[model samples]
Target: MPPPHSLLQLIWLASPALPVGGFSYSEGIEAAVEWTGLDSEANAAEWLSDQLHLSFARGDLALAAQAITAWRAGDAQRIRTLNDWVLHTRESAEFLLQTEQMGRSFVEWLKLHHADTAEVFAGLPATYPVAFAFAASRTGASVHDGCLAFAFGWAENMVAAAVKAVPLGQSAGQRILARLANEIPAAVDRAMQLTDDERQAFAPLLAVLSARHETQYSRLFRS
Candidate 1:
């Protein structure tokens, strides 16, 4: 089993303020608003809510939970396989960049704090969730906690994106975040139970919006 997790470390790693450039990409939200006419706070809230349940929980969160187990068990082969799966499943080029950049940044953070295992992670093909799994593995966080933190971080970033792109007020953003938070626990629970073959990230709308976002003339997000 892994060592006891530091609550502070989990919070810190999940913070949007971390230097991972998470704040820069709207994860296709910008494109959804501009290209697809998703222009209201209510619309944004619903979109994020659906994403949390349909895409994130069923896909990345499950992968992260499984990977935390692999990392804790010192199963390097499983870790590499998980990493490759993430790389292969990205819906678009920009999505791929977001995962790779954030994964690299997270591993760099790990290097600063845990140099010994940093080299191990650095050698693998890092995707954001995969890198996060390795980071959480050291913390001995339960799969639920690890996936919750990951989802919370993604929620914050997405809310920040909406606040900027949809021009939602800060209060509106908080409300959105609150709604997203309410869904995290259940999503985490579902993710923890998924087997590898059951995992999926195939959100067609997100993929379409992401591809359109890449060439959008007046875009505010990376992907």
Candidate 2:
């Protein structure tokens, strides 16, 4: 199949090579693995699939869909509102740091490589989801397509984290990612259908895990 005009850019935005420091965050997965004995490929896959469906696909990606639409329509106040929601809903300091830093990093990436577009964000807080929405609005993909890219990027980074944290093999990590890929499209579809009121960062155990990770005796990932 031929790439769309912005497919390559979509792919780039989703790439682990984007220098957003996404490499440093496990989003509580590391701590969960340590505390919960998520030591096998199957265990890792199950945990991630649950996270995809329960948290990310519903919450972050939904906001991304809204933010993307707002950005495309040049709605600055809507963007700020979404950004504030992300900040206020963070369940832990580590989680908050993870999103904010990645957001700032993504924004800086936009500024360096796509200045004209980044200029729209000069005065806005670009939390990861919102910054992602801002950058993804330029992709020209349907919102679902853009959400798919976001989901895959998240799965890839997360699989890498599982490999290191769970100490799984490369093949095990690949298997976990494969399972996540199978679930992502449906998750993205569900995300696309959500209203702003339904979006929430409401994972209780995940929050506890993330807070514990902040002072974890020894840790590889930041959150």
Worst 10 residues of 2 by lDDT: 1-10
Stretches > 4 Å off in candidate 1: 1-5
Clash pairs detected, candidate 1:
27-223, 28-223
The residue-by-residue lDDT of candidate 2 on 98-197, one tens digit each, is 8899999888888876768556777776799898887888877877777888889999999999999988999988888888888998998899888987
RMSD of 2: 1.4
- Whole-structure CA lDDT of model 1: 0.87
Q: What TM-score quantifies how close candidate 1 is to the native fold?
A: 0.95
lDDT per residue, candidate 1, 101-191, as tens digits?
9988877877887868556965675888988888887776676777788899999999999999988999999999999999899999998
Question: What TM-score against the true fold does each predicted structure earn?
Answer: 0.95, 0.96
